[model samples]
Target: MYALKEREMIFVFTGPHGAGRKTVAEMSGSTLGMKQVISYTTRPPKATEVDGQDYHFISPAQFVAAQADNEFIEVSTVNEHLYGIKSADIELMFQQSGSIYLILNRFGAQTLKKLYGEHVVQIFIYADRATLEERMRESGDSEELIAKYLSHYEDEMAYRDQCDHVFENVDLAHTVFDLTKTLDQNLNRNLLDLD
Candidate 1:
């Protein structure tokens, strides 16, 4: 667990599908004093997912209206479903003393980095192809869906080099430890360099 005395810092986590970015983000936010901003999606909620916890579920019509109104900070469509992060949601998360962790796709992360510039600390999470395939299979996804994800994986991998940190999440425990250490050092540096 991290010492709560550390100042807040916005962390952006991105990765390929089934890379466990959301799980790692939630764990990191709980360990550190930060808020995990649950994104909104037009897709139906999964069996284990809870509204307002995993995501803010919305209808396609509502999502389209929001997009037209420019309510989303970043939005993207994947596999025919739309997902978005709202600007107001981010503002609310950062309102307190704690940091905000935004778990998004590469396109969303790029949009946020363009918007926030140096205020964002981007982390790319990754796993071996076999591990990712096994994970997707365990999740009960169809072969067609898995193949689609595998096709898009390379594009997301290309974005990894642009991140401030690349976390290979094959071993969750060790990855979390390394992530915490890296975050601590980065936070301390940012604090000391505060103007």
Candidate 2:
């Protein structure tokens, strides 16, 4: 894929868990040639998740060491699990591709926007609460975890209006198409000359 602008913008895809943020961001990166910053995690891999592809699964000690080394740009903890996007990962993406994309939670998303200023484009993936819970259930989330997720909907929407764009992930095909097209229109599109 060709690049559109000289001043590349980083894409920050964010929303609550089960909102398909990772799926959509991966699709965008694959199809648009936008590089994504791989994050490191202390959590165990899920069924379909690949080791290097999904996350750099490491130990808590390793994670803390990396944090101390200033290896990550943003970091967060959920329960006993730790997650962070390495600063080197972002720098490498910018070196390879003009733009970059990464998935994050609402807090991380806001942090990225504030850090990058105009260079960041935040897209909030939103779905109905019921749909979110159902998706989580289908993904093998425990009832307890699903309940935990469901209770956070209100807090998630507290800053929804601050995002540059918001959309539902009901239909993957439609949502991807719409989101990509909108991004091209609002961003640089000279690289993607597809008709």
Candidate 3:
């Protein structure tokens, strides 16, 4: 519940799991004066994640009800956990901050791009397979879950061609800097092109 402001663009960061998409999105959003759309999930919070701020952690029934009500802009199941963005949350983010940054899987990103057209800027983040496997292990993902993620690697790579920008998230600081610069340029370009 926030007052309406100027409409804002939507930035969707998509890539393989453990590629630091969320980290880069958080850095970019905070540095650029934009807000992030805290998604809704049926999964429990990680040790470091705050409840309402990071995601609206909910029960399976609650998530299913929302889905039935068509509350989500996009939804995807990963490792048996459901992740989605609520339309209400998005509207609130736009009202409060004029723009939103979000992390999503390849399918979710593509859905958002198709739905929002020019208002959506898609960025694909990836890392070497070895790095990805190591990060996933460090993040506590099980062997099965890691395998599931690996299965999606080909699709994630193919979707990169559809994105507006792509980067390998090797160095966090460098990735943040590069993403910030590219985002600033695109936002400025959009502003000037709005004849």
Q: Is candidate 1 or candidate 2 better by TM-score?
A: 2
lDDT tens readout by residue for model 1, 16-61: 9888888888777676667887889998887778999989999999
lDDT of all predictions: 0.83, 0.81, 0.85
Model 1: weakest 10-residue lDDT segment is 1-10
Q: For model 3, state the Cα shift of residue 115 in Å.
A: 1.1
Candidate order (TM-score): 2, 1, 3
- How far in Å is the alpha carbon of 160 misplaced in model 3? 0.5
Q: Local error of candidate 3 at 33, Å? A: 0.9
Candidate 3: tens digits of C-alpha lDDT, residues 1-195: 222343578899999888999899989888888888877899888777899887889999999999999988789997789998888888877877767888888888988887788888999999988899999899888898788888888878888899999999999999998888899887774333222
Tens digits of lDDT, candidate 2, 51-114: 8888889999999999999887788876558999887787777889877888887777877776
Kindly give the stretch of ten consecutive residues in candidate 2 with the minimal lDDT sum. Answer: 1-10
Per-candidate TM equals 0.89, 0.90, 0.88
Candidates 2 and 3: which is better by lDDT? 3
Candidate 2 residue pairs that clash:
none
Off by over 4 Å in 2: 1-6, 190-195
Which pairs clash inside model 1? none
Off by over 4 Å in 3: 1-7, 189-195
In model 1, how large is the Cα lDDT of residue 149? 91
